[model samples]
Target: MAKKNVLIIGAGGVAQVVAHKVAQSAAEFGALHIANRTQSKADAIIQTLRDKGHRMPFASHALDAMDPAAVEALIRQLDAGIVINVGTAFINMTVLEGCIRAGAAYIDTAIHEDPARICETPPWYGNYEWKRRDDVAKAGITAILGAGFDPGVVNAYARLAEDEYFDKIDSIDIVDINAGSHGRWFATNFDPEINFREFTGTVYSWQGGEWRENRMFEVGREWDLPVVGKQKAYLSGHDEVHSLSARYPDADVRFWMGFGDHYINVFTVLQKLGLLSEQPVRTAEGLEVVPLKVVKAVLPDPASLAPDYTGKTCIGDLVKGSLDGKPGEVFIYNVADHKQAFEEVGSQGISYTAGVPPVAAAILVARGTWDVKKMANVEDLPARPFLELLGRMGLPTRVIDATGDHPI
Candidate 1:
């Protein structure tokens, strides 16, 4: 049988990495197509591929992913067996519906977010994607949620702990430290609307066997990691914590993100000024616009930062529990260099790390290893094959414990 076609939504930094990686691994897929709200952005990504000397058959389409009919139409037109939804988190449900209606496998990098709401509740997956469990199952399709780094590989790390290290996991502290710098005075590595919204809301975590709430940058601790050295990470709300809590309720699951003092100061100022609000307000000219979106518009596009970005990122899960009835802890992580990533895929390390995993998941689905034909979170799937494939694709897994830091 001919390889299946894959359709990727969104034309952002992360999507660029996905497009390039998928193009590199073209033999595993049929025709590769990428769509975005603006066809120009999608064409830009295709052009980047051409500039890199890739000779695969690639196509670009204009898609408003929020419209399920249009999305389904595009999927059908492309004959795509797999739909990678890397668009804004707000379009997840609509894109998921399209995938189901079109009989295509669905994958996404983050949890769905309402354009109007900041933080809804813990177990974020239970709020949106989990509601479609029956729909995905009845359609006999695979839907992988949170295929990005934190929710993606970090979730797999928890599973790896269960499979290899510990008999009972006590706590899972996911530390995401982007030690890389994009050489900007003030800029987010990803979409500003999503990035600012994440910090403006109440930070929710799973602790003490229940849901706990805290302010952004409230609780923090210094961690001496492998490459990044000593860095302070603040407890933050994230997608994996929600699903992982459901999977391992007995364990206290929390997400900690490292932010430099400058970022915290800038973010605090923006929040205090009410510039990060998602609600629409009338401007002086009597036109309504969402402040967060306006801020996003003013911010540098994340993709544009790749050329000047330097340094490395260390993201991992520090799981503490018992092994053979003895106390133990293991840190499963990956260290990615921005320069190396930009050299490989015209995007920075942050994008490259987040982008590579879904393609790995897609390859597994195409290979019949992860095509479970059911709705699943990253943790719910088997861990070994996905991690191994990711290692080969660029983001290799490393484990540090009483033994030492070694590749998986």
Candidate 2:
């Protein structure tokens, strides 16, 4: 069989990390191709690789990721056996379809979203990605959904708990704390539009074998986590909670994200003023624009924050259950430094953390370790190899319990 190539479908910070990591592991792939709506962004990333002295064959292409035919055409033209989709959440379904049509293994870092919907319902995957499960199976293509940090590594953490630590899992609390500083007055860690859209809707959590809902910032808790120390996190609707609830229906699944006072205040004001609305409205001059898009345009690009970004991020799963009929709780997490990430990948810790895992997934697909010809989430696959590969690539996993914090 010919060596499979990887086609990365984005050119943002996360995509930059993916490109670099893929280049570093060049021997695992045939050729690398990156495509985006703007070709220049792809060129810049490839140039960075060139400056870094990476000798991998890389090319850039222009693509409207929302157009499935265009994405499929690029995949076929590149002879890509795998598509690592680090694009915005809105493009997930289109990219998956393209991958299916092109017979390329699919890996995405986030759940698919409808441009017009906000927090459609619990089990978000079922709302979009899961609907295409039959199509994926029939085509015999592997589609690994939500392959980023929280949805990716955290999902693996849950599976690890089931595989080793617990016999009957009870609750899974996924906490994401970005104690990192981007040195900005107010800017999102990723795309401003996606960041704002996540919080502008109802907060959903799975508990007591049922779906629960609340307002964003309505439930806040202070966690004294390792390295980063104590920080305030809010229960927020996220991609993982939906699929996790379905997989571990008996367990309580919730996602908490750290937020400082400044962010809460700014987000509150924006929501109240309707400045975060995704719907388009006409101005006095009859020029139509989405308020959310306007806000995104004014904020600093997330990728730009890599240079001066500092501090660390601690994201992990707090799993509570019974082990050998004894009550137990274990926190499986990884701490990443922004400066270290930028020095290594030319991106901030947030992007680095989110970006690395999909490449690992791609490697597994190439190696046939995770090339299950069907649709699945991170938790549905074997966790150890993926976690081990992540450790070698950049993000290593550590478990905290009565045994102490040690690498797994």
What is the C-alpha local distance difference test score of each model?
Answer: 0.93, 0.95
| Model 1 C-alpha lDDT per residue in residues 169-237, reported as the tens digit of each score | 999999999999899899999999888888888899988988998999899999999989999999999
TM-score of 2: 0.99
Worst 10 residues of 2 by lDDT: 118-127
Worst 10 residues of 1 by lDDT: 116-125
Clashes of each: 0, 0
Error of 1 at 146 (Å): 0.6
Model 2: per-residue Cα lDDT over 1-408, one tens digit each = 788989999999999999999999998899999999999999999999998999988899999999999999999999999999998999999999999999999999999888899888777898889999999999999999999998899999999999999999999999999998888899999999899989999999999999898999999999999999999999999999999998899999999999999999999999999999999999999999999999999999999999999999999999999988999999999999999999998999999999999999999999999999999999999999999999999899999988898999
